[model samples]
Target: MLVVEQLRKSFPTAQGPLPVLQGVDLCLARGSSLALMGESGSGKSTLLHLLAGLDCADSGSILIDGEPLDGRSESALARWRREGIGLVFQHYNLISSLNVAANLAFQARLAGRHDPQWLDYLTQQLGLMPLLQRYPEQLSGGQQQRVAIGRALAARPALLLADEPTGSLDEASSDEVLALMLQLVGEAGSSVLLVTHSPRLAARLQRRCVLHAGRVQAGPV
Candidate 1:
């Protein structure tokens, strides 16, 4: 489970500091999913990054299964990110030199949780068995994203965070990828917090919240 309370963040700007998040609060139960929706400049991605520990919140706290997330050393945060969180972004971010199989196992191995059987199952579930030998460049955007999702789940992370994960794909492909992701996340029994602007996509999740003026509220749209 994840809990965020009064989360606040600001960034440097020519016009003094521009605040992005102001007392934002959210919670996601284990094995559940929530969609974060917001317009441009609404601080959705900022909150996601904070949760991932890629960036820190200037105020407030993030808790994963009751463990505090703020104020950790860089090394500790890095370790937590590698072993406890599974992240997917708009970009596939795959290693160009690595084949699909290697790409999928990369993070899992880093987390010291690699399971060949689970990897194989993921490959099968993602319809990627035949593409295991192929590289990122050889696949379409949808294929590459599936590989990204597989790689994230390969680590068996307790929580999964996706930021605009289907942003690059066509509408049909987006739906397909989202469905597949939810299915696999269910199979893995991992909680998911997906950041997306699409209401349709947001509605597909079990719950939805909107980020407005730096705070989280029940989705209005």
Candidate 2:
């Protein structure tokens, strides 16, 4: 459902415009998952940000289900971010003042697509019912990550963008979190584009692509 064509981006540097993503092409089918692997500075995060609409590519195009992603106004992109996509990061960006239940429901409420049934299902699957009243500070890393994943999937987003989602946890915690994440993503039927450096983690996804020298290539990074 996602297509990127010769996507190119560059950033300002002391020398000049330092190119990052150079003619990167990618495609993701609906409800499928893709792992983007790269060493440091390979522009994996940059490509993810561009697809997330948090940043724009300097040239080329990104299409989702035939709709062009380039040239949109800030407001339009903001709306798309709120309603059309779900995002998770290494850090759990939960609202400190909000408890687990509120945080889980936050995005869904914003999208005007809140579903009590879906939220309940997530709560049950994530084993979050007992922790519903707790805040982020009171939870463990795995617990926090679970809440983050639940919040992202609460809206049943067509796509989910995750960047180093399990970076903060220990090995066991990371494995557990990733497993739960993939299971919930399947239940939610959301397409995933995950940016991570771990090959073990990348292997769990349906497809893996490496970013090297600003271009996407098949196989390991």
Candidate 3:
């Protein structure tokens, strides 16, 4: 579903142009799950951003289902993201004023692809039915993260990108959330690229890749 070739990215620093990803290459099959493991500065999140088209790479190419993504304009990339990608961040990036239901439906509605039955199913599966009317501030961190996961899946995206999704939750909450996420992603038939620091979390995924020194290490899960 996704293929990246010799992907390279760098940012201007006081020292010079510091490179984050150095010729990274990866390919993700449709309906598969991959765990991206790395240290703090290993560019895992940067790689996810590049794959999601949230940021541009300085060089190399990213292809989604065989379409070249490197040269798309910002608007084009935004449209593509709305139609094909769903993102879950470490922090629950929920809108403060919007209630859970509205927040979950927001992106799907914006993409003109809202599915009421699917949204209902998501709410039920994520155990968010009772909390639908509550705002982010009123919910526990685990509940908010559940809402965030539901929101991401509401769009039925082809590719799901999760960056440290369980990082902020307690152990039990984290396990619950991760299990639900894995199940939901499997049911949705979407390929997932999840970035995480925990080995236990990484071990649960179907495949794993470790990022170090801006490059991906090849090995089995």
Candidate 4:
């Protein structure tokens, strides 16, 4: 489960401090999914980063399963991120030097949760079995994105944060990848907070929240 209370973040600008998120509050139950929809600059990605501990909130608390992340040291946060969070970005930030197989197993190995059977299952499910030996540059956009998703889920982290994961793919590929991701996340029993701009994509999830005026609208999702 994930919880956010009065989450506020501001970035320094030439003019002054520009607030992105102000007093935002949201929660997602364990094993559930929530789609975070917002326009550009609505702080969707900022919120996701805070949840992943990639960035610190100016003020507020982010709790994962009742553990607060506010006061953790960088070393502690890094360990927590490696072990507890799975992140998928739009760019498919794969290691170009590593082949698909290595990339798929990278995070799981780092988390010390590597399972060959599970990795094989993920490869099969993501339609990536044949491309395992290829590097990131050799695969199509969809294939590469699939590998990214596979890598994120390979470790079976408690929470998955996907930031516009399908933004680079065509509609058909986007639909395919998103559907597969949801199915696999369910199988892995991990909570998901997917940030996307598409209503069609957001609607597919069990719950949806729209960010506006620096805070999340609606209640529990």
TM-score of 1: 0.97
lDDT of 2 by residue, 1-221 (tens): 99999999999999999999999999999999999999999998899889889898899999989999899899989888998899999998999999999999999999998999999999999999999999999998888989999999999999999999999999888888898999999988899999998988999999999999999998742
Which ranges of candidate 2 are over 4 A from the true structure?
none
Query: Clashing residue pairs, candidate 4?
Result: none
Off by over 4 Å in 3: none
Over 178-212, each residue of candidate 3 has an lDDT whose tens digit, in order, gives: 99999999888889999999888888899999999
Residue 110 lDDT (model 1): 96
Q: Write the per-residue lDDT of candidate 1 for residues 3-91, one digit (tens) a residue.
A: 99999999999999999999999999999999998899999888888988899888899998898999889999999899998999999
The parts of candidate 1 lying over 4 Å away from their true place are none
Q: Against the true structure, what is each candidate's TM-score?
A: 0.97, 0.97, 0.98, 0.98
CA lDDT, candidate 1, residue 67:
88
Q: The CA-based lDDT of model 2 is what?
A: 0.93
Error of 2 at 95 (Å): 0.9
Any residue pairs clashing in model 1, and if so which? none
TM-score for candidate 4, residues paired by index: 0.98
Candidate 4 regions exceeding 4 Å error are 219-221
